[model samples]
Target: MCSHYEAPENERLLAGFGVAPDSKLPIDLWPTHMGPFIRLRHEEAREDDLPELEALTGQFGLLPFWAKDRKLGRQTYNCRSETASTKPSFKSAWKKGQKCIIPVSAFFEPDWRSGKAIPTRITRTDGGVMAIAGLWEKWKDPDGQIVHSYTMLTINADSHPFMSAFHKPNDEKRSIVILPNGLIKDWLNSSVEQTTSFMQPYPADRLKVENRPG
Candidate 1:
């Protein structure tokens, strides 16, 4: 699961992704911090057909509409794609198609081969921005103040040559879904079945990695 990542500086990345800039996001986005995500406000024939996209800032962890308190969101920063449609915390959002795109310049994972968690950076070899699949939810507190939160969707990575190496040696490997640039809109509007098909391993050859001391 991706717990931390570097959100792109809006202007530079939006231009690289050929998207028009809308809002600013924290350069270093953490689980509870506000981060930028893009979603279509209305249905569109094509991604570019929309004059402007909705770029909103939301907390990284998804706070379900039914959640009694915000603390539950801390454990939901990432939702497994395999069970998202059925999981209690994500089922409603999944069924309602509360989808969004999380753009990142790079994400961090723990490499545990040394019996310690080594911080490892993963990014695109081409230096382009990555669009990660995600789901968002709207929750209101007791005072009726609304809050928007989101979760990155992850998939089993046990069979992925590169992704399979992260996390604990004995734990199951997992990775967040990375959507191809042109398919960003497709993922946001996909049905449950189509969304499942998009939760695939990114080509290892196109990924670049840098390991750092924990």
Candidate 2:
């Protein structure tokens, strides 16, 4: 449910969205952190900002290997929950709590046709922001530069009466991780039981998703 989230270089920006830099973006990699992570897309990756990247100090992470190497994302960007239980790509985070919440203004999902992609906006019922579920990991390069990368989680959408209208992939094959505001913490805690309970839909009718001009 996320793709665009910003914590503004200033700490104040987070308070409005209910995130704190010490806890979330500019990303503090502390093991005891909570809250959502804003994935920096390929276009958002500002290599010139090494200082901001260095300032992060590993507060949070993504798939250590995949994010470090772009080649991995050809298959790594979105992990299917149906196969997650067995897919080698996501087995580790599934069993463990190396997870992160992906917060966003709106998530971009495509309605695929012959070859073109039609993008839509799926946001909270109240036109507010949201957090998508994610998994994080950290790895080091040959020269010792640490890279923290992550992948967004997905779930089937047939259950979502509104989302299904968009023909979002259901079948438990590929769905994005979305939770009500209250459950964010429980998922972050990520105990074997907590994660299991989180997988269920959050009462679909309560949320609203409308299609915008493509």
Best by lDDT: 1
TM-score against native, each model: 0.90, 0.65
Looking at model 2, residue 35 earns an lDDT score of 28
lDDT of 1 by residue, 173-198 (tens): 99999988888888877886677888
Q: Candidate 1 — which residues are off by over 4 angstroms? A: 16-23, 43-52, 212-214
RMSD in angstroms between candidate 1 and the native structure over all alpha carbons = 2.7
Lowest-sum lDDT 10-residue window in model 2: 50-59
lDDT of 2 at 176: 68
Q: List, in order, the clash count of every candidate structure.
A: 0, 13
Model 2: CA > 4 A from native: 1-13, 16-68, 112-116, 167-174, 206-214
Which lDDT tens digits does candidate 2 get at residues 46-147? 565422111122322234353444345445556666666577767776776666665555555555532444665556677545666777656665677775
